[model samples]
Target: MSKDTDNSNLTADNSANTTSSPSNDRSANNVAPNEVTFALAQSHFLVGDISANADKMRQLAIQARDQGADVIVFPELALLGYPPQDLLLRPSLSGRIKSALSALSDIQDIVMIVGYPHVDHHGTFNSAAILHNGHQKGFYHKQFLPNYGVFDERRYFDKGRNQVLFDYKGITIGLLICEDLWEKSPIADLKQQGVDIIVSLNASPFETGKQDMRKTMLTQRSREHKVPIVYVNAVGGQDDLVFDGGSIVAQADGSIAHEAPRFLDQLMLATLNVDSNTFNTQEKAPLTLSRESEMYQALVVGLRDYVNHSGFGGVLVGLSGGIDSALTLCIAVDALGADKVYAVMMPYEFTSKISLEDAQAQARRLNVSYTVCPIFDAVEGIRHTLAPLFNKSPADTTEENIQARARGVILMALSNKFGHLVITTGNKSELAVGYSTLYGDMAGGFDVLKDVYKSQVYNLASYRNRLEDTPVIPERVITRPPSAELRPDQKDQDSLPDYEVLDGILTLYIDEDMGYQAIVDKGFDADMVAKTIKMVDNSEYKRRQSPIGTKISQRAFGRERRYPLVNKWSINS
Candidate 1:
């Protein structure tokens, strides 16, 4: 049952309740003879797959019970998956949720807190169900529905106005959904009811420093409330979001007792001392990954899940011997393994000899299947066929574009024949200002570096080389001048500003959403800012047709930033 709305205390007296068996002594308070064993299952669930998710929950529950856990907790929306997005609107989902709940009742030994969607006469709600001894005890609806960037929970759920408290053996416990722990009201309300511990179910997505933020918040909450906390989070990639399963536990003193490894699925077990209001874990806290390592894992997990969930056989990368393609190839091999990755180097007449050598060296180093397909014949054939129609027009970007399109044709043909998904290699800087040829280098099912800037591309390559004992990308690929190699001595700087300057301008204008004048105020050249903004504005059509990619930054092209393709509101600095 829900608590009273008037802030009155809602307490259920379990002093005499002896329905469930106790694992430890119940009366001694000096030494915490009575302790609660909590199993935090940091699981990776498929979105909208109710049956599979329910089955996984059952398996995890049985495993926890076998380990002598008194209660177990799953992540937010574990049964229906997180951010079911508009899927909650479907009437059929209610039936599937019911079936899942019925299936979850089969585990009869331990108590489980499972997150899912709940419906009633009022409306739908993001809720958590409490199961004890194979029966539905009660449930708690999420109180705060986050509505800011990437979160639109208010559109689907009615805010829960009460706290849910349950009794496990001789100890009193409470539950909070993902966003509820972030606010002060929910925990304060639970404190009013005298909860011994707080168990949070989360589906928190990964940002650069999100794990640290979580730990800080949990520490503050525990110390402020003088109550320990056990947090369980969902792990895996869903679309553009990647949840870095870093489930944690904090004692009343605001000290971390255990933290699960990032980007992994784990079952965290801990013991809560009721008398001392502290908890401890046998497992050591996982070492925090470096910035590069964290971002790299995010890309790998995002690509792996997308490929596996989408039912693709493998990935094919267009290795151009440049930093962008070289980094993309390394990510592909790391994500799907070398055997599953195929590297193709399509060189034309203008392609440099050094580029050819670097491409071959990288392919051999990574142990991926390599192919050298010369596109000179294809480029000449197209030009020859169009010569009469054009009346012998002087060669321009059209010829350069033809070379790129020929390479695209080869990659797509290989994909069609072998069922391998093509991975595009264009970086964010080129994409920001329309430097990339649409349907040429952009022709792929996925763009691994669509959100990564050209400046970041070099850093990632160096990071990869340093991460491993041996370098997979050659030194020439990392040190050489960036080029399209579609025309002789064609350097990217000749067409656009230096990547360091261009990337800085794009981040301010695009990611920060600054005006042209505002960007100039940030110590940037006014002419360059205007030119870059103009290119970005004109390239909306190209971006609209670009493939989706993993979102590693605060602002990415596909879902994070949305701009109208035909808007005429240009800022005149």
Candidate 2:
């Protein structure tokens, strides 16, 4: 942590911003004593699109300059996009990145602080540089490399180790990348150098309640260093991760002067008073959302960015009139719009008339392109072929799985022919217990509801309906018991515990990492707990094969939580 200063030395105000006379020694650093306006570029960047990202940065830089901004700060890895993964290994993108950086120099007048992977003979570093009047002013490499949970910077980037401080106009400003601000040494370095403000560029991914944590951390950093901090974060989804842009500008007193909106791409402006070493942030209150609404927006933003960035014409969701598919469909429509979304109801023999009617009714309600592709013949054809092998035994889950496979095949065929991204609808509950048929309902380019549990699916569906003037999801779909409808009278509860109980047990077992007996100790039936754990344990192989989805929780199926698929350890034993 940086050294702290007494509050009595600071001027505090609740209005727009505050200003205070600098100390005698600090007054020497003020050259001209003029205020500098900084534009925080909380923009979206496509992963690995060097040219596009550069073009966007140039446009934003020009816009910032035209708006009379003295400086503009972009998020970390904004040029090549954040967490480029193995794409960084491509020798081809290096030249493009250098070219893009050169092109960015075309914009003059305003100072630009940009983040990118600085590659050279020394190897790649998570880095940021200050540019002024088409020349590099100062540069800093990130001091910390986060390796845990969704972050693997150690695999791709070498740790950065030096402090970058420069005199801009009259104020001495320092630069820090994402993880650098979270650590102590970097801020301490800047404090010792007597920098007035710290401008941090970040590509921090979103998790439940992550913004609150960021605010607390930024406050701590500001208070410790006795320096104001300008935090700029990227917005948009890159694969499973979504960056919720909540850029902030806070004073040494730990009070925010500006806070940008989350899940949105916009430029936020703040003016730093050179003499006072304080600035007025944008005067809008941060938008607050409930936990459910936050998770819902995460799913929507992740899906929308994934589809648009991938160049998909639209999305295709198999609407089975079940809660999982119903919720998936609603999210797709909301994300990509009804015009871009195509819904198909693949009904088989076991599919009830209510399902048939409800699917069509909901499609009509949402007014998306809806089609019915009966899979009875396709499932029968498969059943006939497998009849010889299964003739010795009574029909089991294999038969039920064939119907799901048939529906999956049809959805995929449409996806292939029409160029629509297929969206899988299975929830975390089904995915956890191996209830989903591999390559059947699991076949899709993306899974919107993959991180969402079954109980949350129902709640999100109800929440979606409330967001609309009229209900998009049929009431019966919400009220009716959930069923796969692959077999006659097939209810999910027939195989698994009621979702209320199943989800609770799962939260403890999977999320909380409780032992078998410990979960049972949480008031669940011992047998159910044992059985559920076994199902979850045995289904690792299936989850490993499932499509990647938006991660709304701290412990999602992919990336966040990793378990060996071939493990034999049993909690019950």
The candidate scoring highest on lDDT is: 1
Worst lDDT 10-window in candidate 2: 7-16
Model 1: clashing residue pairs?
none
Alpha-carbon shift of residue 330 in model 2 (angstroms): 1.3
Residue 420 of candidate 1: its Cα lDDT?
94
The parts of candidate 2 lying over 4 Å away from their true place are 1-33, 517-521
- For candidate 2, report its TM-score: 0.92
- Candidate 1 lDDT over 173-209, as tens digits, reads 7889989999999999888887878889999988777
lDDT to native, each model: 0.84, 0.83
Looking at model 1, report the run of 10 residues with the lowest lDDT sum.
7-16
With a 3 Å backbone cut-off (N, CA, C), the pairs that clash in candidate 2 are 257-281
List model 2 lDDT by residue over 1-573, tens digit each. Answer: 122243112221111122332222223122233677889999998888888988998899888877767789999989889879999898886788788888877676677888888888767888886766565655677889999888888998877666766665566677888888898888898888778899999998888899889999999889877899999999998899999998999899888888999999989888888768888756568778877788899999999999998999999989887778788877887798999999999988888999889889988987899999998789889888888877668878888888888888998999999999999998999999999999999999899988888988888888888987888888899999998887788888999999999999998987788898888778999888888988998999999999999988777899888998776687846
Error of 1 at 336 (Å): 1.0
